[model samples]
Each structure stands twice: as C-alpha cells, then as structure tokens.
Target: MTIPKRMWWQNSSVYQIYPASFKDSNGDGVGDIPGIISELDYIQSIGVDVIWICPMYDSPQVDMGYDVRDYEDVYRPYGTVQDMEVLIEQTHARGMKIILDLVVNHTSDQHKWFLESRSSKNNPKRDWYIWRPARYVDGQRKPPNNWIGNFGGSCWEWDEHTQEYYLHLFCPEQPDLNWENSATRQAIYDSAMEFWLQRGVDGFRVDTVNMYSKGDMVDAPITDPKSEWQFAGFQYCNGPRMHEFLSEMNQVLQKYDAMTVGECPHTPDMAKVLKYVSRKEKQLNMVFQFDVVDIGQGPYKFQTTPFNWGLPQFKHAIETTQNLIRGNDGWTTVFLENHDQSRSVSRFTSDAPQHRVAGGKLLSLMMSALSGTMFIYQGQELGMVNFPMEWSMDEYKDVDSSNYYKMVADRSHNDPKEMHVAKTSLQHLARDHARVPMSWSDAPNAGFSAAKPWMRALDDAAICNAKQQQSDKSSVLSFWKRMLQLRKQYSDLFVFGEFDLLDKSNLEVFTFTKTWQNKKALVVLNFTAEEQKLVYPTEVRSQKSELLVSTLDTPASDKLAAYEGRIFMLES
Candidate 1:
C-alpha cells in the first residue's frame, strides 16, 4: 500500500482531448492533428500537466478508430507523423506531457499481421491470431464458445479462407491478439509504438490493457449463464499471463523514464488495481478509475431517455475510491468526463439548466483537490453540458447503443423491453456520452472547424465556447484555472496530503480534511439542489481550517443557494 518513490507524475493534473472532436484545422468536417496543435496555447493556459490523446492511428473508422489497420502510422485524416511530432514538441515546450493511446488488446483485421495470419493455414504468422476449428454439436453452426461480442453477437468471426473462427471481443474486424506468442509480444513492444518514445513522447495510456493476455485454458465452464460478454470478460480479462507481460513492458518503460497507465474497468478493489499499478513491480504508473462516472442512464430502442440517479451513490463511489487509494498501493487517475461519456453537468445535476455553472464548479474543486493525478476532458474547462440534439437513429455511432436497439429492440423475442432499457441506461453511463467535439469558437461550426463536425458538439455551443469563457471572469473556465493553480501552488495540501472523510451525516455535501504538519485544509462540497452547511471539526475548527476556495458567492451559512462547494485551509 505504499508508493516507494515520489515521481513527478504522482501529483500531476492531466487533461484529455479526444482528437477527432478537439479541433479541426483543415475544415474537412473531421478533426486533424493540426487542429490539436492549434489549441496548444489554450490547453497550456488551463494549467494542466499532461495531454492524453485517444487513438489517432490509421483505421478503417468502422468502429470509430477502435479498429486500427496500422498501429504506428497516423491516419491521413489525423495528419502525418511529422504533425504529431510537432504537437509533442509544442507540448514539451509548454511544459506539458503527451500521452498516446495504445490499443494492444486487438488489431484491426486489416492490419498486415492479421492479413498474413488469415492468409493461409501454413503462413508463418498463423499463430499470431487466435484461430480455432468451429464447434459442431447436433449439426449446428456455433461459435467455439457461447461468448458474446460487446456489440451483441458472438465473439468469434468467421474467416472464409482459413475455414476457422478468429476471436474478437469487439467488432469482427477487430481480432484479439494471441499474447501467448512471445514473438508477437516483442513485435508490439518494438513496432509503431517505439517510434514516438524514441522522439521523447512522455508515456502511454494503455487501452483495454488487460485484454491482451487471456486465460489460455479453453472450454472453461461458465460462471454466469445469463450474461455472455461478462463471462468472457471475467474469463479473459485479468488473465494468467497479464502480470508477466505487463512486467516486461514496465522493464522497457523503466529504460526510457516514461509512464504507462492501464484503463482498468471502474472497480473498487485496491488489490485488483495494485496488481498492475503497484510499486513492487511498477507495471504501470496509475490506472484510470471509473468510480464516480457510473451514475446516470436511460432506456433504449423503444425508450431512450435518461433517468434520475440519486446523488448519494455518486458521493459513496467517490469516497470508496478515495479510501481504497489511501489504504492501498499506487496512484489513481481521477476524472469526471472523457471522450466516451455524456457531459458531467448533464449527469450529476438535476433538470435545471441554470444550476450547471455551480454544479461544474463544485465538481471541479472536489475532484482536483483529491490526492493523485486529475484528468479534465476538453470543454470540461468551459463547463460544456451534454449535446441536447435530437439524435436521429442514423446519426448515432456508439456500438453499444446501436447493438442494443437492434437486438433487444426488434428481432429478439425477449420478454418486455426491461433488459433493453437497462442496457441503454448503462451505455449512457459509459464515457462515450461526453466524446462530442469541442466548442472553441461561437463562429461557424463553433470554432472546431469551418466545416461540419463529425459528431455534434454540445447543444449550447453558443455559451460554452472557449472564446467566450476565456473572456468572462465568472466562467467555468476561470473556476477551473483557479482550481488548477491552487493545486499547483499548494502541493502540500493537494499532492501528498492524506485524506480523512468527514462524518456521513451530510449526504447533500461531501467533506474531508487534509493535514500535514500544523497545516490543515477542510474540503466541503454541496451535492444537492438546496443549500448545505458543514459544522467544522472540533480539533481544527477554531485553530487550523480557514476558507481556502469556495464556489459560493457567500457561504451557505450566509445565504440559501443550491450547488455551492467550498474548500477551507488551516494556517500552519
């Protein structure tokens, strides 16, 4: 449960930008690498330390860049390798780090490796992909197992040339790699990924890192006969060879002085997270924890509207995650929104649009002040809310939502639409909700581009534009700037500070204390629509804690207002 070394990354604040939606330079409707480069000044101004980019690799775009045809090459839509190099240089020049998304769990069926593997049974690269003979029982065509794809069908994709089933946890075009092959592992470590590290890229944000090493023992008995992907995820995810492979990767990273962060599913067990990010082995620097992001959802197909999620659960998950981190090993990557989620304002607050500002500010202060690295997705700084567009069925790109509509919505003879509704609600909870394009200007296309956007930006781009927020002192952007600067300025209070949760009586507000030496800081946040108060702790109320940062114009004790948050500090 101890972090042996005090590395710089242990306390850095990271900002994530989904490249395709960040900014489009060429006015080609889709965003390019140059678009991101253009926004460098804006990002640097916000006081973020690291910029994590989702996959920009060349792909068929079938699953919206998840299916990478080339692991190393930048897609022409994103720009050339030279463009990325320029972005990396700009980031370093501005004193920020660059993080690349590594999708090593699977390769696009179009990848040269998969092409060769699928070419013939006798091909030298035949063993690189998982291929097995189809199962036959009672003269029926079936997958080798009852495993299902996240997209709703079988995990097995048929290969016409080889007369075999190739495994894919996602789209059929994305075939899972067989990590048992040592040669394949070496190739992944050596290929397109090494290109950036040699050029001084800071680190990697490993995508679906656990999927690479699956349990090799085949025909395992099902644990839950109801859910397919869950069974497969349990079987293959966090498998036998994961630690060995991650340790080897860590060895390479150790030589370069870079970092690696695995995208582990949002779970509460520190022991599970410690397996990959702990110091004894140091396989990864941290993991993206998805504790608070699980709230909010809706029904799908016949019904597709979000429902109210109680706020207490969100506070509980956050406290639970913080306690786990405080009680265990390694650091945590904390975030409220990202490329894959619906906007935070829409998720956390009630239906009142007016409360968005107070809500955003409250969320920012509470999350950033917590110990460990903080991740602020783009537009989060500007308080971007969810896209209010009435999305037609044709405009949707999310795989999970689309599949549920088709399977449980239409052909499946499932009883009622309860399961489909539940599936839709969960998809809404997934991070994809917030992945829409950033709104940089209120100009045509909201300054993201001069052309149409690939995905719609949030509905209120007029008010949420960076150009607008940058000028207003009371804007969400300003609040974020203040929060970020405070953290950087008061490292002792934020970076290495120990967290102690306040009494649980205030469910409408969350409070905590951070003490080091004689200095103390009390953090309080109001989560409900009504005003809330925190009775200061007996030990420090009179001596140490003082008002440090507050989202309220006046303390709730002074006036009754909804969505106010406060952070108080004690004199040394």
Candidate 2:
C-alpha cells in the first residue's frame, strides 16, 4: 500500500484514546501508556490510521490534563516521556500517525510560569498571565469582569499572594495563559509544539484553539444578555490576534510537516474554515466545528430551553459545512463524538432501540461520506449508549457536568424531583460517558484493566463487548469495519466528493448525495422511531444502487425499521 503524499489525513481514520481510561497495564486502577501499547493490535485491527491521545502532561488533575504543570514530561501515572516515545514508535510501526493533545490555551496555576507571575506584582515574568486588581465600577467593588467560568464561578481568581485577580476561563486551578504577550506565546510554542514535533508526534488536537488569543477589550457589556453569565463564550474564543498566534505556531510546526486540527466552536465560518487549511496557510489543517454538535438544544446543559432541532437541523448543519469547505477545495475534520459530547446513536435515535444501529450508521454516512478527515472517538464505532440510571454521582468526572447539577437544580426551579433524570441527562452529555473504557472483553471490568476502571463499566458488557462483536457476524463493530474498508476501497467517494443537499422538508430523516467525477453515492438516514416514507427527489434515482452498508433489513421487504441507515452507489 503506497501512501499518497497529498492524502496524509484524507486517507486517515483517527481514533482518539483518552489515556486515563483506555487501558491499565499496572494494577494501579488507572490507564497508562503501557496499557495503550498493549492494545495496539486491537487499535490497528480496527484500521485506525491516526491515534490522537489526550493530554497526559504532569498535572494536579484540576481539569484533568488540560491544566499542565509540566509541558515536557508525562505524568508518573500515565508513564514517562520515554513511554510516549515508545507509543509513537509502535504507532508508526503499525503505519499509524499520532497526534498529541495540545493544551496550550491554559496551564496549571501551579506551573512555574504562574508561580513566578504571582510571586509579586512587579516580578520579572509578572505579565505572563492575565492579572488585574479587584475590579471597581462607579466606586463599587467587583471582580475583573462579569464573565462566568465555564466550570461555574467567576472567571477571575483573586491571587492573595499578589493581591490581583487572575483570569481562568475554565476551572480556577487552570489559569488562562496570557497569549497577548509575544514572549509568552513564543515560549509556549517552543515547549509544546517544538519539543513534540522533534520527538515525533505527527500533529496535535489543539485544546480550545479558538479560546487562545482572546479579546483584548476588558469588561465589555454582555453581548448575550440571556446567557446566565451575561457574556458570550466569544469573549475568550477566536478573538483578536488569534490568527497571528496561529501563524506563529504554523511557522514552527510546518518545519516538521506536523499537522494540527483545532477544536474550534462555530468555526466553519463561510470562508473562515478554509483560511487555516489554505495551501498558503498560517496554521492548522482542519478544525472540529461545533454547530452540528450543539444543534438540538439551545444549551445542551439546560433541558428547559430545548429547541427541538432534529435531524433536519443537524443535516442542514452538516450540509452547510460541506458546502463551505468544498468551495475552497479546503480540508475539514468530521467527528460525531469526542471527550466532550453526547453519543450520536443516542442523539439521533430517539424512539427505536432496534433502529439505533441504523441511526448511528446513518449519521456516519451523512458525515464521513462528505469530503473531510474523519475521526471516530472510542466506542463510537460500537454504537455505545450513555450510562443510564445505574451511574452514581461518584462515578462521574467532569467539571461542566458537576456544575450543571449544582447551579441549575440546586439553586433554580428546574425541577428537583427529576434530579436523577436531570443527572442522567447531564451524565449522558458528560465526557465521562464516552470516557468509559471500550468493551474489549466481557471480563468483570470489560477487560479495560485488571484494576477497577475510572468510570463505571457499562453493565451489559456481555452483549455489547468487543470480543463478542468481533466474533459475531452481525454487530456495530462489523458494520464499522466494513464501512472503513469501503472508504479505503472508494477513495474518491471518501475524499474529494462534492456534496449536494436533498429534501430539506424531511425532518425525520437525513439525506444527501456525494458525487465525484462520474461516481455517485446516496446516503439516506432515518433518525426517528416512526415508520416514515421518504419520497425520493428526481435527481437522486438510485433505488437499487447496491447497498454498501445498512443497519436494518432492506426497506423493500418492509417499512424501513427504526434506525435504518444505508449507503448506496447510485444507479445510472
């Protein structure tokens, strides 16, 4: 298999491995890099071309590894930097690329940079992070701004040592880095990008990439007044100087042909998405746009303001992304699940338990069939559902979720009787749900580790375990394997195809067409439980185009069962 020079990521299928829960080699009850090495065969067997490992940086675990205490060394629990080197060697040996999580937007408050910055107001490196006196307005005492932290409190933390408030968009312990300072940005670039590229990482999934280079203006009036915090997330995401900082990063990473994909929110901005991926680019190859993921509800955290945006809305979002990126012949990275998201199978399959598989495949077709780099977060291939009521509060580990439970229900009129229901919904949306270990074996702990797993293992592991699915003729895993192989089989369909939207009227189903040169693929997916009929548009006349993949029996035999999805080659 000769690898195409131009198709480095276009030919790749990235599998994200959250190190803390992937697998545990030692009996210490936490997953480590050695555990990841032990599972290479399983990952390679699934046809993964890229392994995007989450941050394993030495940290206080305040916000997991998002808060880095040491940018150059691995946490002792996960393993040493030498262990990461071994993982990289093994991955490349298996013909796979590795993307290290880039969490440069912020650092642990305990980091030496912050330690010096807080040592004194006039410390030599005092300007390395956002610092301000306790804010005052009209002679009234106040915090620096009205911005609320993503994890639930004031975004500013008062540093008693320095008598100043420091900015922290996330948790207080994870202070936002002052990217405005040239030296600070350059130094961070040298440590995170320069060191890793030299050590042999293929790329990075920049954490909160848009959140770096935040707005320079301070204490602006709340743009989104309805937001509980009153300020929009834009205050810290993709603000002024963002491109400048990215360009600086691009200069360094490009020296090693290292790729980057930013987890950008609302980022496929018409022509904006192409800017980074331009053949004459500044930084990054692609970004994970969030509009599609946040489609259904106004705020996924709040159930009261449910907007009821369904497949129609989600389909439209995907189509818009395809059209926007295709216009520039640019790149895009598509994802259905990640460390922070509700599973697609559950999101799209509302009523039918049986149709969930079809629903999952349907989402896959609509997204993957479009021209872009594709990423399948762990367990997404298995159509994994969210943890149900069995989940106790202690099993969860997400600041966003813990906050959602406290501030919303504990203080407001969101219905306390449905505390468990609310908790379950929030739990489903929590990163920990997807963070559950992949069901490799049906052993007592799903064989993720000999020790007790981080999050509770899914209870029905016997039926959904990977060992059973691998041996069984019919399984979500089988469907995914076939789909991946087919993507490799029809390279153009998976890469350079042009996407055309069809029948926006069908709210219950998602439909689209992919055509490259003369080849065509029609993808239709049913998202609901009802036995609905889809009247095909005249342009898409491919009833017998040979179903390449399906989640249910052919509709010709009966009404398309709930959750039925199919990808087909259009008949000329």
Off by over 4 Å in 1: 1-4, 217-230, 266-268, 296-309, 327-329, 411-432, 537-544, 556-560
Error of 1 at 295 (Å): 3.5
Off by over 4 Å in 2: 1-5, 138-140, 220-228, 266-268, 303-307, 350-353, 413-415, 418-421, 542-544, 553-559
Q: Best candidate per lDDT, number?
A: 2
What's the alpha carbon RMSD for model 1?
3.1
Give one clash count per candidate, in the order shown.
11, 3
Candidate 1 residue lDDT tens string, 16-62: 87878888888888888898998889899999888988888899887
List per-prediction Cα lDDT, in the order shown.
0.75, 0.76
Q: After superposition, how far is residue 176 of candidate 1 from its true place, in Å?
A: 0.7
What TM-score does model 2 achieve against the real structure? 0.93
**Which candidate tops TM-score?**
2
